[model samples]
Target: MNPLNPLTPQDAPTPAPGVYVPGYARAKLGMIAAGLLLMGLGFSQFAEPLRLLLFGERARAEAVRVVKTKEGLPDQVLESDRQVTAALEPRDRSYTFWNEFRFADGQGSSFEVRAPVGSQLKPLYPLIDEEGLPTTDLVVYDRAHPERSAFPMIVSTWFAPGMLFVIGTLCAFIGSFLFYWAKKPIELPRLPPTAPATSTEKD
Candidate 1:
C-alpha cells in the first residue's frame, strides 16, 4: 500500500476547478470578443463619408464615383438607406447620418440625409421610409463639366453613446455572475439557548 494514498480501500474522487478558474477567464474573454465585434460594427457604420476634400488633387482624381444628383427623382430607382459617421480631431462626440436615394420615370425624388442629434441639425429631418422621401441639395454646373457637379458634403450627426452603455452593462452582468459562483457560502449565525426556569437559591 502506498503511504501517500489517503484513501484506505477506495479511489478518491478528484475535485474540479472552481468557477473563477482559467476556464472562466477564457469564457469571459470570448464574451468580450463578441462584445468588441458588435461595438466595431456600430463604429464602422459611423466612419463613412469622410470628407474627400482632405485628399489632394491627385487623390481626388482617383475618386471613383461621380457625384450626380444628390437627391434622386421620385418614383425612380429605389435605394436602401445608408449610414455615415465622422469622429474628427478634438471632438469627444461623433456624428451619424442616414442617407438614401430614389428616382422615377422622368422626374426624380430628392435624396435626404438626417441627423437625430447634432449641432448642424437646424431644420429637423427624419430617416427615409418606404412611404415617401425627403428633400436634398442638387448642384448643377456646366453640362460639359459633369466632374465638377460632384461635390463634397457632410451629413448632420451626433455622438454614439448607446452602444458603449450596452457593452458596459453586459460586461458587468457577466463578471458578477462569474464572481458569485466562485465565492464560498457564508456560515449561519449561532442562536443563544433558551434559559430553563429553575428554582432560585432564595426561593
Candidate 2:
C-alpha cells in the first residue's frame, strides 16, 4: 500500500446508474392525468356562462310568477305570503323555486322562459311590485335561442364555475410540480480523485 495515496482502486469504484422505479413513474403519470382531467372538467363548466356573457341579449322580462316544487313532486305556485317562510327553510329540505318570465324579442315575437338556475331556498328576484302585481326584471337570453334564458345573477352565472376553476388550477399546479420532480435526472455520487502512480528506481 502506498502511504502517499490513501485511496485504493477498491475504494474508488464507479457508482452504478440509478435504477427506474416503475411504481413511482406510474404514480407521477396518474397525478398528471388526474390534474388534466380536472382542468378540462372545470373549464367546460364555464361554457354556458361565457356564452351568455358574450352573445346574450339583455332585456326586461315580466316576472310572471314563481313555481315552487319539491324534488319528484308536482309544481305549485309560490304564494307571496309563503315567500319568507320558504326562503328561511333549510336547504336540505329539497324545496326549490323557479321564476317564469315573459318577454318579447326584437321582432316583437313573444317568448316565455324559465330561469335556467333554480333556487333551493328563496326566489332569486322579487316577483311582486308595490301594487301587489307581478313586476319586470332583467334577464339575459341567447339571441339565437331565446328559450334558453337566465337571470343576470352572479350565483347562477359564475359561482360554481369559479370554484371549480380554482380547485382545478391548484391541482394542475401541484401535479406539474410533482411530474417535473419525478422526471428530473438522478445524480450519482461522485468518486474521489485518485493520485497518479509513482515508481522508484535503484542504481
Candidate 3:
C-alpha cells in the first residue's frame, strides 16, 4: 500500500541518477586559479609605478646627473620594422634617447648607465645645447643593481595587466557561483502501464 496517498497509484519519489559533468567541474576549478594568478600579476605590475609615485622626491635626491654627448638628435631613430600595408601611415616616430649616466662612487670608481629607448626622464641639471651641438643632462640612479634600474612608466603598461585582473576576477566569480549553484540534470524512471481489468459473475 502507498503510505503517502492510497487513492492514487503512484511510485515513491526517488533521487535521479547523478550526472558526471567533468568539463564543467574542470572549468570552474581553472577559473579560480586563473583569477588568483591574474590578480597577483596585476598587483605586481603596479609595484614600481606606485613606489615612484609615493617617494619620487627621495629617489630624485639619490639620482646623479649625467651629460648627453651627441649633437642634434641621437642616431638611434630608424624606420619602423613593423610592416603595415598603408604607405601613408604617419611614419614619423620620436623615441626618447639618452646617453649613459656615469657617476663616481665613494671609492672613486666610475659607473655608466644608459636608460632604455622610451624612458621619460630628464636630468637634474639643465640641458646644454649650444651652437649646432645638442646636449642634455640626465638624472639617473647613483648606483646600479640587478633589480633596481630607472625605467619610465607608460599608460600601455597598465592596460593588459589591469584587463587580466578584471577578467580573471570575473571568471573566478562565475566559476564559484556555478560550482555552488548549478543543478545537475536528472533522469526520471519510466512508469509501467496498468493491466486491463476483467469482471466475473456467479449464478
Model 3 agreement with the true structure over 58-165: per-residue lDDT tens digits:
121122233332347544422221111121223343323233444444455555555433332332222233442233332233233422334344344456667877
lDDT of 1 by residue, 92-191 (tens): 2222222332221112222222222233211122334245644433222222322322223323221343465467557656765654443333233445
Model 2 lDDT per residue over 36-87, tens place: 7776776787777577767898888987778877878787875463564554
Model 2 TM: 0.67
Number of clashes found in candidate 2: 0
- Please identify model 3 stretches exceeding 4 Å from their true place: 1-23, 55-153, 183-203
Model 3 alpha-carbon miss at residue 144, Å: 9.7
Q: Is candidate 2 or candidate 3 better by lDDT?
A: 2
The Cα local distance difference test for each model comes to 0.33, 0.68, 0.43
Task: Mark the regions of model 1 whose C-alpha exceeds 4 Å error after superposition.
Answer: 1-23, 49-134, 137-165, 168-203
Winner on lDDT (1 vs 3):
3
Candidate 2, position 203, lDDT: 88
RMSD in Å for model 1? 15.7
TM-score of 1: 0.27
Model 2 clash pairs are none
